[model samples]
Target: MRTALSMTLSSFGANRVDFASRIHEALSRVQRGDIDVVLSDLSLSHPFDGLRLLEELKTRNLLKQSAVFMIVTAEANAQTVLSAAELAPDDYLLKPFSGETLRQRLVKAVAKKQAFKVVDQAILQHDYLRALAECNARIEERDPYVIDFMRLKARLSLLTGAFLEARQTYEQVLRIRPAPWARMGLGKSLFRLKDYPNARRVFESVLAENPYAMEAYDGLAGCLEAQEDLLSAQEVLSRAAARSPAIIQRQRQLGELAQRNADWPVAVDAFRNTIEYARYSFQHDAGDYAQLSQSLLASGETQSAEQTLAQVRRAFHTPQSDLLAHVMEYGIASARGDAVRAGKSLQAAREQFAELKDNLPGTYSVALAEACYRAGDEQAGKEVVSSLLRNQHDDVAVLRKVEQMFVAVGRESEGKALIEDHANDVVELNNAAVRMAQAGDLEGAVHHFLSALAERPGSMPVALNAISAVLAYVGQHGWHDAYMQLAQDLLARVGAQDPTNGKYQKMMQAYRMVRQQFGIKGA
Candidate 1:
């Protein structure tokens, strides 16, 4: 293969090397931007291939505008073409081609890369409009990059939230050629438009033609899940996992789906594989370890569950993981019919939980609630569940999970009634506070909100209201040190509990306004 490539490059008066064989050496040079025009086979000897190398290079910000990648392969099967298309190769050169053929292909590939350099530069600079315009100009000029740039314009449309335009471009591309990339883009655009049925069929067709297209599987899974087809969605992810087991997220999803199906054995296996494969990647999560322990206990392997919990404790030594290990212990003991140990674990965890000056994250709170319920400590469990409900009342997924946990512990009736009563208690407190503020009694409003916070310490809505009520009271009545401190602490909980919320950024600005008026430190 190298000899063939050498003969081709020599006749074209171009330098070449076998990047497939000397992958590490080539990648090292490529990383330093010392290599260009990578002519490579479909696959390399090692796990990382030419396609993967290009992916890694892009990840490292090394794939510059000058890079020209042309797939030189003897085999251009559906799988190969689909994989190559994903990387957006400049061109493909099949075997049995003469030196002149190789020269022509390389020239065309380089020219395409160079012509699209303006668009690439614009994209890198985050100028989607300019990139789209350049693509449009090329298409109008009938350039060789007509199809590629058309797809680029579609992708930019998708990125810029022009889903209808992207759908139109993808449809046009499909008419030109029955291509997987166009079909996948069509599925995505349709998914964005909330046309789940059409998107599902489009993705299914793509997968039918190329089963190795992971993106198609993901899109199809999304479509199924959007339509509430959990069983079929799980089947799709299961198929994807069979094809590629090393994806931690897919394994985790499969584990979650198996759990939803009450398939404990499959859940256990999926989570176990998640743990094993996660060791080789940077995407490892303590949740997978905790979940594996839960699955093991569910499968009646108490000893193995304990050992896995211990392993995670050693693996992650953070305060969060420390809390997680105790949560796992409670679940394990409860499952093994050791209520005494389970209760002891929850008691210890509660003490540690309360020792923190912040509210629990939703994920941590859910784990604790499950453990507390299993240990027959419904009081602590109720408090944790209340925290979650108060923090995210609008989240259907959270509501469903809360019900599932209660059902699992045989407390469905009690859980439903408790959530409703506690929810009403907080809502009444918040509503009264809002009423007081409306009537111009900021003092009374602040008091009511504080009372609500006392009941549901994780309530962001109440916390934000209390902060506002206090700010208004102070604006009229002058600053009280304790009131200011309360406002700051409430803001802190907003960060500790759910910093990912879009509200966090906006609320931070409000917090800063108060801080500046009082000449205090940052929020």
Candidate 2:
């Protein structure tokens, strides 16, 4: 295939073509030079494939706006195709194609890439509103790729949290043609709008047309989960995982859903797969080991659970991991009715928790709280959970998990009261700052939010509010470098934590516009 591609390109008067047989070599080559095209096969050496290469390029931002990536593979199964599509490859060519056919596909791919160059540039800059405007302008011009622009416009709308516009754009595309991607987009838009029943129907329709659509399955599962249909959601995710088992996030979600349903065996298998697959991906976390051990314990495999905890101690050397291992050990010891071991583990966990409480993730803190409750340290448990709530006051998922933990320990009412109190405190703090900003005391608002951030360093809402206050001050007063830098730092933190957040995207767009307005260069 390489020889054929080279010959075809050479025959077509190509300027130059570089080839690499391995993923690392390919990445190195791309890093060394500006390449216009990347051609890869789906299957490469074990554990390294075309998809991995694409992912690496994307992660490093190696692919320029106009660079075209084409995957030439003999594998045409639904899983392989959907997997490649998830990465949004420019083109997928099956093997045994003629030289002329390859040339045509390459021409079309390059053309499409060129057509969306402006929109892609804006998107690369995180100026999603500009990108959406570009898409709309291009669509109005009636370009040859109008459908592509329409699709992109719908996606940009979704990214900007313009769910109504996204729904309308997707509906327009579906009226033109019942494309599965458009249907999926429509479903996602509906889901965002909290129209779960309609979203479910749309996703179901997509699956009816193409049962192997992995994204459709995911969308359907999300809709079901939103409607509190845990069993149905778990089943949908199970089927999706069976089809595309390489997706670590899907496996992790499946495991969590199964764990929620108390399907210990399935949870064990899914978490095990998550751990294994995560080893090769960026989604790896020490929490995966903790989850697996919990599942093992629930399944009456205390020995395996202990081994899993031991593996965590070996696999990760962070304080968080140490704390997690001790917590899991306490659970294991309690399951075995070893009072002495349980007490020792609980003591170790408490010490670790005390040392790392300020920096620990909410999930780990929750685990520590549960261990504390089991050890009859109700005060310690309450204190840990309260701190976690303050840091993550706006995170509904974490709050739900904390409530569940309390309920498991027969403290549901107490948990509710604690959650409500913390939530109201955070709300009042935020509202006070917002009132300052509304009253034209922008500096005061910024200072208030900064103080809040110092107190609750891990609060996403506080971070976002601080950024807004800083930006508002900059916009109204002038470009204060310290305030701008502070906003940028907060944005970097938020981006690192949740890059896909719509609010973050909007904030980024606002940040860029502020810089541009102030004639700030080289940001």
Candidate 3:
């Protein structure tokens, strides 16, 4: 394929063509020089494939608007094809194509890339509204890539939180042609709007047409889970995992679902796969070890559970991991009726938690709370759960997990009451700030949220509200350097927490607008 591509490019009077047989070599070459075109095969010998290469290029911001990326792959499987398409390659060429065919495809792909240059620029700047407008204008021009622009418009609408517009755009595209991507986009829009039944139907329809559509399976599973059909969701995810076991998020989702269903063996296997698949990926986490150990203990495998904790201690030599290891040890010891060992493990865990509580990830709180309760430290347990609730007041999933933890410890009613209390507190605090802002007290509102953030340091809602208030102040009162810095810092924290969050993306767009309005050089 490489030889053919080189010959084709040479035939087209291209001055230079570079080739790399491995993912690392390709990445290194791209990093070291300016490359105008990249043609990669779907199946690479390394665990990282062509899709991963494309991902790395985007992550490193190496793929310029003028440069084209085309996938040259013989693999015709739906999983590979859809995955490649999702990354939005310039074009995909199947094997056994002629030199002339390659030239034609390359020319067309380059033209498309050139046409979308402005739209790409807007997107890279996090200006989705501008990009959406560009896409809309292009669609009105009846260009050759009208469908592509329509697709982009739908995607940008989703990013901008215009779910109804996204749904409408996707449906319009589907009316023209039943593209799988369009169908998936429509399902996503419906999901965002909380129309789970219709979303489930759309995803199911996609799977019926293309059984290997892994994303369709995921969407269907999510809809099922949203409708509280855990068994069906588990079944759907299990089928998807059987077909493609390399996706870490899918494996992790399956593990959590199975754990929720009390299918400890399935949870163990899924989490084991998640750990293995994520070993070299950024998705790897110490929480996976904790989850695997919990599943193992639930399945009456205390020795294996202990071994997993030991692995966590070795793999991650951080305070958080040490705390996690000790917490798991306490569980294992308690399970084996070793009261003395359990007490010692609990004491060590408490020491580590004392040092790390202010900045701990909320994921570890449940286990720590459970351990505290088992050790007869009800005050400590309540404190941990309360802090978690304060930080994650609006996260339904985390709240559900907290409720489950409470149920496991036989304090379900207390959990419910505590959750309600914390939720109300956060809501009332947020409302007070909103009222202050509405009463022409933007500065007061900003200060209010900042104080709330001090009390709930890891609270995403609080941080986002603080950012909003700060930006509003800056927008109305001119750019206050301190206020702008506060907004940026809060944004950084929110991005570190979850970059894909729609609210974070919106705040980023707003921040950029503010900077641009003020002639800020660094925006």
Report residue 418 deviation for candidate 3 (angstroms): 2.2
lDDT of 2 at 189: 93
Model 1 earns a TM-score of: 0.62
**Model 2 root-mean-square deviation:** 3.7
TM-score of 2: 0.87
Instruction: List clash counts for every candidate, in order.
Output: 0, 0, 0
Candidate 3: misplaced stretches above 4 Å? 1-69, 76-88, 95-104, 474-479, 505-522
lDDT of each: 0.73, 0.82, 0.82
Query: lDDT of candidate 2 vs native?
Result: 0.82
- Encode model 2's per-residue lDDT on 377-479: one tens digit a residue: 9999998998898788777778878987887788899899999999899889988997887888999998999898888888877898889888888998998
Instruction: Score every model by TM-score.
Output: 0.62, 0.87, 0.86
Which scores greater on TM-score, model 1 or model 2?
A: 2
Q: Give the TM-score (vs. native) of candidate 3.
A: 0.86
lDDT of 1 by residue, 1-523 (tens): 6686677677776664544454455557665654558766654222334454555555344555556877666664624544514446666677767777878878876766776677666655444565678888988898877888788788777766678999999999989998778888999999989999999999898888777777687788888877989889889998887765655677787898788777789899999888876654445678788878878777888899989988998788877777878889888887778878887777777877775424455556677888777666778788777757866664556676777788878889987986788668767777788788888889999898887777656567777778878878876787688988887788787756544333443455565677678787753
